[model samples]
Target: MSEDLPIRKIIHVDMDAFYASVEQMDNPDLKGKPIAVGGGGKRGVVNAASYEARKFGVKSAMAGNLAAKLCPGLIFVRPNFERYTEISKKIRAIFYEYTDLVEPLSLDEAYLDVTNNKKGNPSASLIAKDIRERIFNEIGLTASAGISINKFIAKVASDYNKPNGQKTVNPEEVTNFLEQLDIRKFYGVGKVTAEKMYQKGIFTGLDLKQKSLEYLDENFGKSGRYYYHIVRGVQNSEVKPNRIRKSLAAERTFSENLSSEIFMLEKLERIADEVSKRLAKSKVAGKTVTLKIKYSDFSLQTRSKTLPYYMSDKSIILETAKDLLYQETLNNSVRLLGISMSNLNTEANKKIEEKSVSVQLKFEF
Candidate 1:
């Protein structure tokens, strides 16, 4: 680890099987049973699975029918986003009690910088413990947390002890911790990237650290620099309290695959309406309009057009999406259609540069 790198108390908190847990919490009959949160109808996907369901190899995003096949008698419950959002708001309220420097990644996870928390607590580990305990008590939900010197390590550690647990990588342990970490477990390394690293004979952080910057860049392009620093426990990105929206999107999977452009036009209109509503609600518009198509074979294709002016009108968005839709020939029957707007007006809302800690702080939990 470099001596000049920032050392701040960062914590990543993630709720356990949030949607499934919420369903179980609300319905006593669903407790202690294998359940998945999402529609069980054809074309339905699992949004979240209970631990009992997971034991049978059922997981989120799996086809609902496949999940049922994996776990015989697996119960599927429709998603209740409104209820989930209600619970999420309560959980976020608890975070604000400890620190204003809270960054929510989603309704189920967040990152908090508690180095200068309201409680004046110096032990980030204890702070995480307190937050988890409060969530369990107040919201009837279990949360796992990771505490460390920076966001990347903290995020990784949070997964170490999941479903009601916490892991802390103290300042002194950061180097050894990261060096022993599996390359696949590094924050930004996905399945494809992990395979790429494996081909390069890089299976662990120690292996990644051995590669020169130019060597990594030559092979991995822009993410090469990210791989270089994170392996050395040198991530300096801060948790932004006001994380601005970069894009607004909406999509839907049909009950039956559409075989022609005319059938998709109505569906695209509805999707555009949703995207336009989201853009209006966010008070932002964009120059880029993208249309995403998912064939019945599960292949995805996206066509985008950047206009001279920003658009948030449903009619205009529908017109652009229709153009993009006809721009390419159908590869197969379409299972899903989506519309997204990017190059947002929110870009101007970005705050000025925020500095990370430069001096080492003597601390222990």
Candidate 2:
């Protein structure tokens, strides 16, 4: 596998605290405060929490009520999707300015393969630095970047210097770097998996590398193969640019089935807010809004509205979704309600410019 691998240059760019950062960027008054974005009501859930809130044990996906309890004076705000979508588009545009081999993980993170970049910059470190500066100057948001010969090392490098910073992992230093890294820090190793590794006395990349591939496979199942390769600084994942997006949706499974018109409408408002936020972050407007309902009896139904104009507005999206929901008769109590936006705009493309390669770093292997 190593014999066929290309000497590639990969950069992983991740925006620090994406949703929370957007909120702070939009409103200066909220800066440096413990802020959470999501539900403010009795059944509210946190969609995003700022770094300040993180210090107080607040986190995304946690119940908003619980989050408020964890941090005194925690401020909660509903999400704004349209604005986030606009900012995401601007950031993506900046990425295309460097190389077209860009693979977006989400609105705020992506991987770029610049091994044969259009700009012909020999030093991947310099390219990452340039990208970081441009994002701060143009988008008014800070981003962290990592540059390396492969994605695994690059991702770790990016996190080393975060919140408006950049770093590089040269090929020669890869071994020493991985040797000292905690086992939990290895990609694809999550909390449960890390705990299992710790039980087996696998606490660092060096320890993982010492295990035979067959032995790892017997214990970790399919993931053990991935661990074996990454510990050896081998990653084959490609920077797949222009990957098609699927499954654009928003949904809410109510705590209880509801028949009240006013209550249903309020829930639709919150769902629309979430759907819009994601749409804006992707910089794509949707032509279809699908409303889904699951009855208490485990029966399901869906209604959709196709708009003449693509939209990312919260009001327009919610109104359309509500209209679709209202079109159906509420003969049975609805237990789950969902709204999804699809048929996104795909006009964006990456562009790489031309330049001379200045220097090449030789690998000792």
Against the true structure, what is each candidate's TM-score? 0.95, 0.71
Specify the highest-TM-score model's number: 1
Global lDDT of each model? 0.90, 0.82
Alpha-carbon shift of residue 127 in model 2 (angstroms): 1.2
- Residue ranges of candidate 1 with Cα displaced over 4 Å: 1-6, 349-361
Which parts of model 2 have CA positions greater than 4 angstroms off? 1-4, 244-249, 255-365
- Per-model tally of clashing residue pairs: 0, 5
Q: Which ten residues in a row have the lowest lDDT in candidate 1?
A: 352-361
Candidate 1, residues 146-251, lDDT tens digits: the string is 9988888889999999889999988778778888999888877999999989998999999999999999999999999878877877666888998888888999
